[model samples]
Target: MFKSVDLKLQLVELLISSYANVDLSKVKIIGVQHILETTHSMFRSLYLLGLKPENIAIIGKCYSTCKEVFEEMLDDGIYVDPSSSSYCSHKSYDEWFSLNIENFLTSQIDDLLSGKYEKILVLDDGGKCIKALNKFSINTNLIVAIEQTTSGYEDIRYGCFNFPIINVARSATKLNIESPMIAQAASERLYLSLQRKGLKTNKVLIIGKGAIGNAMKNKFASNMEVVCYDRNQKTYDQAKVELSEIINQFPLILGCTGKISIPFDLHSKISPGTVLASVSS
Candidate 1:
């Protein structure tokens, strides 16, 4: 038996609309995720909708650090078992997990199709898992995917996605607050830490000028010198020297672009100590 809990209204509406004709009693969500509050909240929202804790399997490193939350999910009846969870985002946290990403997703899909569940909700943050699911879920009963990151959304937009995709990255409200604020907060912490290390923090070169990128630029401009580069030819044309010269001279380089924006031709020219910090990742 599950306890009565309040569901976030926005998530309630989204889930209601998405599951319109489906029986909520038979739904399961396999969240291939990251360690974030939104992820935790999503679990809560789904549980409140009557999804059994045993039907939702979270596959990621989120289970590594957040022991309390993980225990709460289990205690509350969220579908989590030691043999089924895989939790590694980067090799840096090598002690915590070694990501067997392929094997993990394949196992999840196998279980998803083993007749214990009716529908599956995939929260593929990196977009790679959805691509994996696309191959296996071709003849499945029901599987819905939601791409949570801009990079993942781009992959879907470019036709990597075969199943129905709910691009949460495109939501203006989430775009306006969650991403930008996270980027800002991350950059702030990066700057402070570098400054503490006695590194020069006065001048920062930020690549890309999107919402989060622009927010970082503006936040830094009040107290430091900020330079920008956009890969768009038109934008690049406006500041050719800025991208070429500033990269070589600046001791700190901030990557606002999720993908590499540093031209391969210019890579060797950058100063050896120049730090390449990605606020997005």
Candidate 2:
């Protein structure tokens, strides 16, 4: 376990390394998590990247977890936990959460404008928080937005915030799971795991024309008799395969359309033991 002083030094070293290589003064990050585990991971990554504990702010329900992590990492004056709650429970908390979240973010904005911090990272995609930031016209040089849900992205995008936003969607691929390495590794691991369980030659059906679907198709086509069903006529034409033919021919299916609807009568047409996988955004 990394003690408070050790972690703080590590963070400082990481930041110095980053600054030496790039520009640290230009980077700021903010994030929120509904779960403790997710929050831990996000903070760990950010700290390891050289962000000071004081420069970071979190606004969510899990105050206890944040406190523990930050306290363990930072020295006496380096880190501070301003949340009232000690523990994080995703359980219901009447309207207080929303109010508190807004208050916390608004306060942070004040700190930023007072020259307390240069860069800012907003973690939640909540309408109110985004609106608050926008209304105040916070002079944050850089803003990194992290959200777990697709609805959050829509909220921020359509909420009329003019800032440059980067949404780290953790819950769905449509947000954070973007790296080709992670995608390829996940695909390979899933494919191999399925193969080990006597799922080789599983008729994998994909339903999308996007990059992820294409990557899946390219990776799984050689091993399994893969078929793609896409509404994009251009993609269908380019693939040299018809959607109807693919739907009629394959039973084991994988969906990548980012939409919730599953194409074809999966229950009626697919074999009873057929495997189905969804890699949607």
- The most accurate candidate by lDDT is 1
Off by over 4 Å in 2: 1-18, 21-28, 32-50, 54-116, 123-159, 166-179, 195-197, 231-249, 259-272
What TM-score should be assigned to candidate 1?
A: 0.73
Candidate 2 lDDT over 44-121, as tens digits, reads 555545555566555544433445655443442232335535433553332455566656766666566765555666
lDDT of 1 by residue, 54-150 (tens): 7777655543334455556667666443532444555333233324445566567667767766767787765766776676654444778888878
Candidate 1 residue spans exceeding 4 A from truth:
1-24, 61-99, 138-141, 232-237, 241-245, 261-268
Count of backbone clashes, every candidate in sequence: 4, 6
In terms of lDDT, the poorest run of 10 residues in model 1 is 91-100
Question: Residue 267 of model 1: what lDDT?
Answer: 90
TM-score of each: 0.73, 0.51
lDDT of candidates 1 onward, in order:
0.66, 0.54
